[model samples]
Target: MKIGRIETFYVPPRWLFVRVESDDGAVGWGEASLEGHAEAVDGAFEALRDRFIGHDPRRIEDIWQVSYRGGFYRGGPVLMSALAGLEQSLWDLKGKVVGLPAWEMLGGRVRDKIRAYAWIGGDRPSEIADAAKVRRDQGFSAVKMNATAELDWIGTPRLFDEVVKRVEAAQATGMDVGLDFHGRVHRPMAKQLAKVLEPLGLLFIEEPLLSENPDGLRQIAELTSTPIALGERLFSRWDFKPFFEMGAVDIIQPDLSHAGGILECRKIAAMAETYDIAVAPHCPLGPLALASCLQLAACTPNVAIQEMSLGIHYNVGHDLLEFCSDQQVLTPEDGYLRIPQGPGLGITIDEDAVREAHKERHRWRNPVWRHSDGSFAEW
Candidate 1:
C-alpha cells in the first residue's frame, strides 16, 4: 500500500509521535522523541514527507536507503531521529498488513521475555534506597540512576565517595543497579569514577565518558572492569564502529529511536555480536519506543536488558504509556517485559489523546547546568 498521509505530534513532557496511513486506510504509529529537541525532529520530517508520500509502505529497507543516501547530509540526531520514527511507522504498517509481529517478520522469537530496568533518583540522584525499594515492590529486579549532579572538571575525593554511597544505597535493596554518568563526568573524572565504582558490581556504567571521547573511553576501559555502556548519542551503526573496533565497550546501549529504527538496530546488534558485546537498548522515551525495543529484544540474542521511562524524572506531567490505549501492553511484569505477540509494534495508540495533548504542545528543554566556577557543565 502506498503511504497517503504522515503526521507528527509534539506531545507534553517532551515526546514526538509519528503516524502514517496507507492509501487503503491502514495506520501505524511510532515515536521519534528526541527529548529536548522535538521541534527540530518535527521540522526534519518535512523533507521525509516530501520524499515518502505516495511511496510503497512495505518497502521498508528501500525507503530507509533512499532517506539516508538520498539526503547528502545525513546521520545525526535530528535527521536520523526523524527518519527513525518514519521507518518504525513503515515497519509497523507492514507487520500489520502481513498479520505478523515485527519480530516474527525479522526472523523469529529468540526469547519469550526480556529483562527491564527502571529509572530512579532523578537527575541529581539522591535518596536512592527508598527509590530502589519502591521499584523492587513494583516487581523490578534492577534500577538505574544518574551517578551525580553537576561537577567541576576536577573534583575532590569526597565527591567520588558520595557517588559510591548513592550506588551502595540503591544496592542495599538487593536490586541490580546501573549507574549512568550521563556524560556529566569529564575524562579526568570519568576514569577516576570508573575505577572507584569498579568494585560495586554494577549492572553497567552508562555513558561514563560520552561517546565523543573514544580515546578517553578506551583509557577508562583499560582501567576498570565495569561494562562501559554508551551509544545513546551515537546515531548510526557507522557511529558505533570505532567503539566496537577498539574493544572498549562490553555492553552497547543503542537507542532504537535514535540509532535508526528496528532493522538498523538489529544490524548494529549483529555487528556487536562478533565482539561478544551485549545489547541493552537505551529507551527512555514513550511506549512506542519501548515497544520497538521489545521487538528488537525478541529476536536479537545479545540484548541483556531494556530501559523503560515508566517513572523517569523527565516525564514530569506525562509518564510512559500515557498515550497508549492499553497501558499493560508495554508494562513490565516481575522485572521482565514480555515481547509483544500482537501485530506491528503490538501496543495500540490512543490517537485522540495524542492529538488532544498536542494542542497545548510542550516546549520542554533540558536544564543547562553550570559549574561552581560558572563554566558550562554537561547535564
Candidate 2:
C-alpha cells in the first residue's frame, strides 16, 4: 500500500511522535525527536514528508537513503535524528506488515535477555550512594551516574575528593557503577577522575572527554584501566573510525535515537566487536527509543548492557514508558529486559494518552549554569 498521509504530534516532556498511514489501512508510529530540540527535528520531519507522501511505506531502505543522503547538507543532530526517527517508523511498519517483531527480522535474538542499567544522580550529581543503594535494592544489577559538574581545565583537589566520595558511596552497594564524566571533565580532571575512580572498579567511565577530542580520550585511556566509553555525540559509522583505531576505549555507547536507529547501530556493534570493544547503547529518551535500543541489543553479540531511562532524573513528570499502552511489553525484570515479541517495534502507543499529554506539551530546556567568576559552566 502507498503512504497516504503523514501526521505528527509534539507531545509532552519533550517528545515528537510521527504517524504514517497507508492508502489501504495500515498505520505505524515513530518518535522523531532530540531531547531539547524536539521542535527542530519536528521541522525536519515535516520537510521530509514531501519525499515520503505517496511513496511505499514498506520501502524501508530506499526511503532511508532518500531521507538521509537525499539532502545536500547532511548528517548532524537535527537531520540524522529526524532520519533516525523516520527509519524506526519504517522498520515498525515493515515488522507489522510481516507480522513479526523487529528482532526476528534482524536475524532473531542472539540472547534471550539483555542486561539493563539504570541512571542515578541528576545533572550535578548528589546523593549518589543513596541512589545506588535504591537501584540495587530494587533489583537493578547496575547503575550509572554523572562523574562531575562544572569542572575546570584545571580543577582543584576538593572536586576530586567530592567525586571520590560519590564513588565510594556507590561502591558501598556492591553494584556495577558506571561513572559518566559527561564530557564535563577535561584532560586534567579526566585523568584524575579515572586514576582515583579506577580503584572503585567502575563498570565503565563514559565519555571521559568529549568525542571531538579523541586525542584527549587516548590520553585518558592510557592513564587508567577503567573501561573508557564514548560516542553519545557521534552520528554514523564514519564518526566511529577514529575511536576504533585509538585502541583506548573498552566500550561504545551509541544512542539508538541519535546513532541512526536500530539497523545502523547493529552494524556499529558488529564493528565494535572487531575492535574487541563491548556495546552499551545510550538511551536517555522515551519508550519507543528504548524499545528500538533493546531490539538492537537483543541481536547484537557485542552488546554488554542497555541503558534505560525508566526513572532517570531527566524524566520529571513523565518516564520512559509514560505514553505506552502496555508498559510490561517493554519490561525490565530482575535487571534484564527481555526482547519484545510483539510485532513492529513491539510496543503500542496509547493514542488517548498521547493526545492527553499533548494537551500540555512541554517547553523543556535544561538549566544553564555559571561559576563564581561569571564564566559559563557546563550543565
Candidate 3:
C-alpha cells in the first residue's frame, strides 16, 4: 500500500506525534518530539509529506535515504527528528501489515527485557535523595539526575561536596545513580567533577561535556573510570563515528528519535558493539519514542539500559504514558521494561486525546540560565 495521509499533532508537555495512514487503510504511529522545538519539527513534516505522500509504505530504507540525502542539508536535530518520526511510523505500518513486531522484522529477539531508569531532581542534595527514594518505591532500581543546575567554569569545594552528598544519599536508597552533567559543566570543571565523582559507583555520567567536545570528552575519559555516556545531541551514525574511533566513550546513549530512526540506531549500536561499547537509547520523550527504543533493545544486544520519561520534571501536566491507550505495555516492572511482542511499535496511541491536546498547541522551550555575572550559562 502507498502512503495516503501523513498527520502530525503537537501534544501537551512538549511532544510531536506523527500518524501515517496507507491507502489500504493500514495505520501506524510514531513520536518526533524534539523538546523545545515541536513547532519546527511540525513544520519539517511539510517537506516530508510533499516528498513521500504517494510513495510505497513498505519502502522504509528508500524513504529514509531519500529524506536524508534528497535534502542535501542532511543531519541535524530538526531534520533527523522529523525523518525519525516518519521512518518509525513506516516501520510500525509495515510490521502491522506483516503481523509481527518491528524487532522481529529487524532480526529477532536478543533479550527478553531491558533495564529502565527514571529521571530525578538533582539540583538539591536532600531533595534528590527523596526523589530517588520515591522512584525506588515506584519499582525503579536506577535513577538519573543533573549533576548541577547551571555551573560556571569552575566550582567551589562546597559544590563538589554537595554533589558527592547527593549521590551518596541516592546510593543509600539502594538505587544506581547516574549523574547527567547535562552539558552545563564547562571543560575546566568537567574534568574536576569527573575525577571527584569517580569513587562513587555510578551507573554512568551522561554528556560529561556534550558530544561536540570530543577532545574534552577524551580528556575526561582519561581522568576517570566512570563510564562516559553521551550522544543525545549527535543526530546520525556519522556524528557517532568519531567517538567510537577515538574510544572517548564507554557507552553511547543515542536517542531513537534524534539519531535517525530505529534501524539507524540499530546500525549505530552494531558499530558500538564492534568497539565493545554499550548502547543505552536516550529516550525522555513520549510512549512512541520509548516503544521505538524497546524495539531497538529487543534486537540489539549491546543496549545496556533504557531511559523513560515517567515522572520526569518536564511532564508537568502530562506524563509519559498519559497519551498512550495501552499504558501497561511500556510500564516498568521491577525496574526493567519487558520486550513488547505485539505488532508495530507494540503501543497504542490515544488519538482523540492527542487531537484535543493539539487544539492549544504547546510552545515549549527549555529554560535559559545565566551565571551570577550576567553571562550566559548552559541549562
Worst 10 residues of 3 by lDDT: 309-318
In candidate 1 the C-alpha lDDT for residue 34 amounts to 93
lDDT of 1 at 118: 88
Q: Residue by residue across 178-281, what tens digits does model 1's lDDT show? A: 99888888888888888889899999898888887888889988998888899899888999899999988999988888988999999999999999999999
Sorted by lDDT (best first), the order is: 3, 1, 2
Poorest 10 consecutive residues of model 1 by lDDT?
Answer: 121-130
Candidate-wise lDDT, in order: 0.88, 0.81, 0.91
Top lDDT prediction, candidate number = 3
Give the TM-scores of the predictions, in the order they appear: 0.97, 0.95, 0.98
Residues 162-199 of candidate 2 have per-residue lDDT tens digits of 88787777777777788887777668777876887878
The number of the candidate with the highest TM-score is 3
Mind giving the per-residue lDDT tens digits that candidate 3 earns over 19-49? 9999999999998989999988899999999
